[model samples]
Target: MNAALALHGLSFNYGDRTVLRLDALTLQPAETCAVIGPSGCGKTTLLHLVAGLLRPTLGTVSVCGQRLDELSVSACDRFRGRNMGIVFQRLHLLPALSVLENLLLAQHLARVSRDGAAANALLDALGIGELARARPAQLSQGQSQRVAIARALVHRPSLLLADEPTSSLDDGNAVRAIELLRTQAQSIGAALLVVTHDRRIRGQLDREVVLGGAA
Candidate 1:
């Protein structure tokens, strides 16, 4: 299988404290891998490193076979914006912007043009078509989450990273959201990495990787 992201002997520390120490991992294309563990087990650290938000102190981190160590920070940021779609816990939508505008803004940041038809179609699919004009402040938690999903997916990235994406959702919505993420990843031929402490999503993943586990 083709790898979308790979990490080799990844170890990171914040001053004297070591946060993550993974030997190796390679996520296959279209693979929906879940990183499941305790709060400080470094699930977020791993995702941040993969997303190029953090640098590894040891070994190499690669995305789409390009070694992160080789890429400059600015280049990494550009690569991340273009190739990775991230659904952060906070959603990070601009409160002043409407739903359509938020997605368009994200697309612009990725240096890609907005696909209005596709964006609207995705919102419609998420059952939020009528919310196109609604700002983030006007939407409920569920609606906001779907909009975040839409924003991440607007550019059809090769990797989709989620940090406990469905934590705020109810059981049904959580399952549906996970399914939607995986389904969209499959449709775009992207690898999906969902980091979560929620055990409910454990059984729904294609493969489960526990942080700090011996392999």
Candidate 2:
């Protein structure tokens, strides 16, 4: 079977400055890995590259056997929607929509059929079923984080990317959040790649990739 994610000679630069460089990286389906590094070490940049939000300045990123560099803009968006799920550091939930609507929107954007049952099931699994109709502004930080995670997995993506997933939680919640991510990703058979500076979660993952300080 093809690797869930593969990066070969990946390097990203901004003008004259180099931000990230990785000779090779790979993650098999249902495997879990963490990218741990300092503030400017391109942890988030790596996530974006894999998600196809930003193209690498050099080399290639392949997700689910398809090279991101080979896909057109529209095709890339579609592929990302169907094959990848991202829990951004900022938790970009729509304030105007209810929690359930946010998940439905993800499906709509991905061109997948809207399945309210699946959406609610994911919310319930995350232990936030009752909050499904609540607006983003009404939830606590931890609640909002869970909502964001639910949104990402609503479509059962093949690759799950999370950035700083536990940056705001206390020790207890941090552990719980990481466990939720791992359990959910495994259930969907997605490869889990987390970009985090939090050392608390390092031991929970299968392996860790430490990036050097910003170049």
Candidate 3:
């Protein structure tokens, strides 16, 4: 199967420091993959490259068969807005927006027509339907994470990238988070890439890519 995400001869640097170097990496369609490494291993950096938030110093990032490097900055942003879903550790929900409205904003930013029903359905699927009208400040940590996940999937993106998604939760919540991420990705037929150093999540994914120095 063609790769849902691919990095060829990827290398990234910041001035004098080289943060990441991958000869090749690819994630199959609907695959759940984890990128594991210690701090500074470029786990998050790799996601940034894939999402077009950062340009690779010396390689190409291919997503859904298109070369992201070939697109202009604005074009790349549009492509990501339309096809990618990113869940940050911070959950970045606008505190003032209700759960449902937060998701609507994602659709608007993507320039896609609003689909309130689809947004609500996603919230229901993520087990956050009851919190639809709740403000972000009113949610528990787990609920906040669920809202972030629902927001990411609200548009039914083709690829989902999550950074340290379960790092803040207790072991039990962490496990639930991983399962939710995996199950939801499968249901949506989207490739999932989670970057974290937490070994608790290792067993939940279909494949793993270990970054950083080898022993």
Candidate 4:
């Protein structure tokens, strides 16, 4: 089977500082994996690299068989918008857009047809349908996070990348969030790769990929 994501000789450097190094890594279709490590272990950096938000100093990142490193900057952006869904650690929702609008914007930016029905269904599935009109500022951390997840899934991306998705929630909310992510990803046939420092989410995933640790 083709890998949904693959990295070989993946190393990232920040000027004189080398932050991440990985010989090989792969995540298969419909498979869920958690990337766990200590602070500054380059877990988030790895997510950025895979998402095409950052270019690796060495090695290549391939998503859905396309070599991200080989694409032009504009081409990479278009590919990422169409094929990848990223739940940023900061939950980068536009403050001006309401819950529903934020999701709609994702569709618009992806250049896909705007599907209000699908967006509404996703918000309803995530249990945030009632808050569709609420702005991001009005949401609590958990609510905002859920909205972010819904936004990520609106485009039905082949690969979902989430960074520190449950770091702020309590145990209960964190578990719920993880389950929601898994269920939603499976439903959409998207491979899930979540990079988090939260050990609480380790056992909740199908497998764990530890960075900056013994092999």
- Residue-level lDDT of model 4, residues 1-215, one tens digit each, is 67899999999999989999989988888899998998899998899999998999999999999999889999999999999998887898999888889999999998899999999999999999999999999999899889989999999999999988888899999998999999999899999999988888878888988987723
Alpha-carbon TM-score of each model against the true structure: 0.94, 0.95, 0.96, 0.94
- Residue 124's lDDT within candidate 4 is 96
Provide the clash count, candidate 2: 0
Candidate order, lDDT descending? 2, 3, 4, 1
Off by over 4 Å in 2: 213-215
Candidate 4 stretches greater than 4 Å from native: none
Instruction: Give lDDT tens digits, candidate 2, residues 117-196.
Output: 99999999999999999999999988998999999999889999999999989999999989999999999999999999
Model 2, CA-based lDDT: 0.92
Per-residue lDDT over 14-36 for candidate 3, one digit per residue giving the tens place of the 0 to 100 score: 99899999999888778999898
Error of 2 at 127 (Å): 0.7
Model 3 lDDT, residue 175, Cα: 97
Off by over 4 Å in 3: none
Tens-digit lDDT track of model 1 for 53-82: 888989788888888778888999999999
Q: Which residue pairs in candidate 4 collide?
A: none
- Candidate number with greatest TM-score: 3
Looking at candidate 2, the ten consecutive residues that score lowest on lDDT are 206-215
Model 3: how far is 79 from its true place, Å?
A: 0.4
